[model samples]
Target: MSDLPRLSSSRVPTPFIAFAVLAILSLALAGCDGQAQEEAKPERPVLTIKVHYAPQTPDRSFVGTIRPRIETDVGFRVPGKVAKRLVEVGQVVDVGQPLALLDDADLKLQAEQADAELRAANGVLAQAQAAENRAAELRRKGWSTDAQMDQAKAAAAEARGRVIRAERSVELTKNNLSYATLRADARGVVMATAAEPGQVVASGQGVVRIARVAEKEAVVAVPETLVARAQGGEAHVSLWSEPGKTYAAKLREFAPVADAATRTYLAKFSIPAADDAVKLGMTATLTLAEPASERVARVPLSAVFNQGHGPSVFVADAATGKVELRPVTVKSYETRDAVIADGVKDGENIVALGVHKLDTAQKVRVVSSLSF
Candidate 1:
């Protein structure tokens, strides 16, 4: 007993030692719990965009072709073999310019025949007139009967009718001979030629295709949904070769029916300010600008969040640095963005990415895309 060492005053007893250990353990456990709580409520950094509202003047563009306002297919008025094609494709021609010539041998022969028939009719008339004069002179001497005088008058009248018909035949043949040449009715550029030097074409067959360059137009196929808007909207045209230059265009014609295959309406927009540079068959872009439409917010597509309820977005509070899942009315989705029709006020910060991991009232650090 004596040999056992007495505990010093500076040393604690077993109970106190055990109590101290327990208290230290409790403090350590509380500290760990507090640290875990702090770590769990982390400040998540997210990319965000500022919301801005503007009148959606949606401009729709369509590929089109520059064309002429009036295109006509001219052909010869008389049937004959094509002798020569005077104009080639892309040749500029004026009104009354000969485009093609037909073989005029047949036409010339018919005219000669008509002239010979007229001469014969004139000779017969002369003979009849001389015979009638002789008959009248005999009747005056009382040597001619009344029947003979009547017969002479009828013969002269019939010969005069034959001469009148022959003269009309000569005029018809001359007109037909003039029709052997195909002429341009309007000043334009020739687009195509169907008749070669030796092709035989009937009357009214397309021999040459000419497009009037006085007025140019942009032709495009518009979707059925935008037909009405396109007609009332202002149009502008730009050529692929000259993108910087734009010509004001006006809607001139719209097809009443939709095309069967494409389900689109054919629209022709006249370019009153079109210059010579706007050539036929050039690729063009037609843009239609609508009047000020409804105001909407366009947000990045990744900012939209959906969890079986509808489309919503996480809007960050500027003051609290917290995010709130907001229900938004999405009007439409485009290639890279979604158009928000409503439920988002102007000048709000919206989380632009990582919306799936966000929750209501979650604290976040709003970072701009430019910061990167």
Candidate 2:
């Protein structure tokens, strides 16, 4: 013991040290294997939807304005400076009611001139008739030549024709004078005024826009895609002022062509039961329910996944519990859902959320809607 090195209490045996190192290395290796296995595991369960196809009767809504069945621009029949405007925008007018007045000074002068001419013609006719009677008496007495009597008779006839022409002129002038006062052709409401007092307007130029209130209609711009639908669909109108009430409507008129700027068709729906509450120019909502033309399924927007390969969704197999990426043809997108036209059949399960994180042909557990 004195010659050899003494064993220290803190010193460990070589065999024991080797065994401890081996045990620690084995434990570390085992931990790494477990972590790798965990990382390689399949994804958790995903929310899904079981699609059901049915007749697709989409409802299309459009913002429109309440209008009249007959709206026309009314103007004076005679050209003149506007002396006064009797009706304003939004004024209710009856048939024959004066809407505006033109300056009648020239018209009055014309009427007076016509009347004077007619009076002069009458005087000339009276003088010619007396002369013709005298010539006939003289001829009958053999004191006047036949030529003189014939000339007198011709003069009388000419005077009578002149009088007739003058009378017609007088009537025409009177009509023109009356035309200077623009009158309403029908009972309507004034929508707009184009001519003001003292403004010169040509004959037939619009002075006021009148809308007949006997029948009501809704004028709306429909999307080109929905033009056919609007023509044959059922329509309902709701006024912005009276939201609680809705009136049934029928398609009255639809434009054959689309507007140049908006590429939309102009459509008018007639409301037979409209009342006073449905005033002209009021805001209205027109909803058209299209007939079912095809079979389709509605799915959530989140279910659709697009990765530069158009649109696709993950569908889970019922037997294998595995998901397969399926390409879907989306017909249209709604507020919170999408209408699928093709590429998937009825009774197929589709992943709803977290679509971007999934891979094709992966296994997933199906979760209920409440748990999700």
Model 1 CA lDDT for position 112: 100
lDDT of 2 by residue, 122-200 (tens): 9999999999999999999999998999999999999999999999999999999999989999999999999999999
Clashing pairs for model 1 are: none
Error of 2 at 101 (Å): 2.4
lDDT of 1 by residue, 74-144 (tens): 89889989999999999999999988899999999999999999999999999999989999999999999
Could you estimate the TM-score for every candidate? 0.59, 0.58
